[model samples]
Target: MTSPTLALDPAWITRTVAVALDEDLGPAPGRDVTTQSTIPADAVGAADLVARQDGVVAGLVVAPEVVGQVAARLGLAVPSVDQRVADGTRVARGDVLAVLTGPVQVLLVAERTLLNLASRASGVATHTRRWADALEGTGALVLDTRKTTPGLRALEKYAVRCGGGTNKRMGLYDVAMVKDNHVVAAGSVAAAIEAVRTRFPDVTIQVEADTLDQALEAVGAGARFLLLDNMPTPLLAEVVAAVRAVDPRVELEATGNLTLDRAREVASTGVDYLSVGGLTHSSPILDLALDLEPLQPV
Candidate 1:
């Protein structure tokens, strides 16, 4: 059976690729001098997108989209992209992920930009997979935070999903989360929850609590979800029992300073979700390279 692939917003891919291509190619007066002078415009070439290091594959579709956009900009035929592996597939070093064939110059032009998207997304997926694997068999789920690269949130979060992690909330618009600052400004957890509930009656409201008192207070304010911030495993377990006693339905999420080493222990505390910021912000780029095959006469 074939693995399912991710679907991205076509318009977002187009806009992002256009900006990336423009940045690399510069303005019309400036050109890729080396390719322009050496490679003939009609010269056809093929290249393989190879993995320099093992990682989970993500954003395979985006690479082709970027190639097609660059081809249109340069008036070259869009390259044929044959993706050998689906997103979420684990690959080893030297694995050929995809094949690209078209004008050599166009291929060179799109090379770096396409690799940037794929490598970055794959990096996030690879890191997230570790967390998912760590929490395997635990009832808790690995979740991604909003701390993602600007203009790449959707793609990054999608990569997390591909890595077996769940997305907590897309943005501030999707969920109402009252944190410590909001509680301070509102004078209490209940007050903050009340204000958000009064303003956005239909949204899911989650309150952040630093202590057991605040957690109980949040539950009293009709918050069905609570974010237990920075608590140790023992305290987290205690809070879980307390909250469950008050209202068994109140969902709890543990956040702050969550490291992969402690993921299983934290999940054992009975929290429903473990939100990790490092999944996107701190993941190293997966090493990938585009190796051009020798040119042949058409």
Candidate 2:
């Protein structure tokens, strides 16, 4: 399996793993009470991170780091995790994504945290893959919105990319998105575009248009990127034609109420992108489990 095209920052992964471990095990004197009481300190064994349901695999690379951090906090030997498949690979229910070996206590301590991160990431990827598949053969691309979990934006966005979906904007800092509120505050689409242009000349400005008139006004104000919010198929087609007539280079995105069943119909409207907020916010966690092999007598 080939690696994903997008790169995840090593420092970010390490920090995220550290923070997650801290949350689960607590700070400094953190301990897994059950494991500490039941398992012998020197008892060592192996376990497999197995999929309980068929889905795309993700977040395997971060598993080892989680194990190390949890073990370090517990004063135990860090477990080794070997990824069996690359992220984004289509996996079956029984597939092993990674193998871990270390003190039984350490393995048990890291299991839930590892499964939580990987399962959540894989769920987003799986949901996004369906969108990508539905939009196949259409020139339009699938994009994800800012409706991600509060702290898992980076991991969730990375999963989206792995599943062949594009990121619209990382945050408000990267691109200027003049939504309905922004337009209302600025008086009009033209005024909003002008204000954003004056403040951040180099940033790409995307204006939201609810009707043909607003669409045309945005284009008239030199905005080339437009988000066609919640417009029906026929109205979207009209807006597409109207914008194309003004400038063929303008990029149009269709968003709001975009579902998997409506992907083709929306894409057929000639919009350049279809943005889905559910990719991150409402995706269910992919089922995953860790099964430990019995430790042999030393």
Q: List per-prediction Cα lDDT, in the order shown.
A: 0.88, 0.88
Q: Write the per-residue lDDT of candidate 1 for residues 125-223, one digit (tens) a residue.
A: 999999999999999888888899998987898899888888888899979999988878999888888888789998899889989998998899898
Winner by TM-score: 2
Error of 1 at 110 (Å): 0.4
- What residue pairs clash in candidate 2, if any at all? none
Each candidate structure's TM-score, on Cα atoms with residue i matched to residue i, is: 0.95, 0.96
Q: In model 1, what lDDT does residue 198 have?
A: 86
Which tens-of-lDDT digit does each residue in 18-110 have in candidate 2? 778778878855877888999899999999999999988777778878888877787888888888999989999999888899989889988
The Cα RMSD in angstroms, rounded to one decimal, for candidate 2 relative to the true structure is 2.3
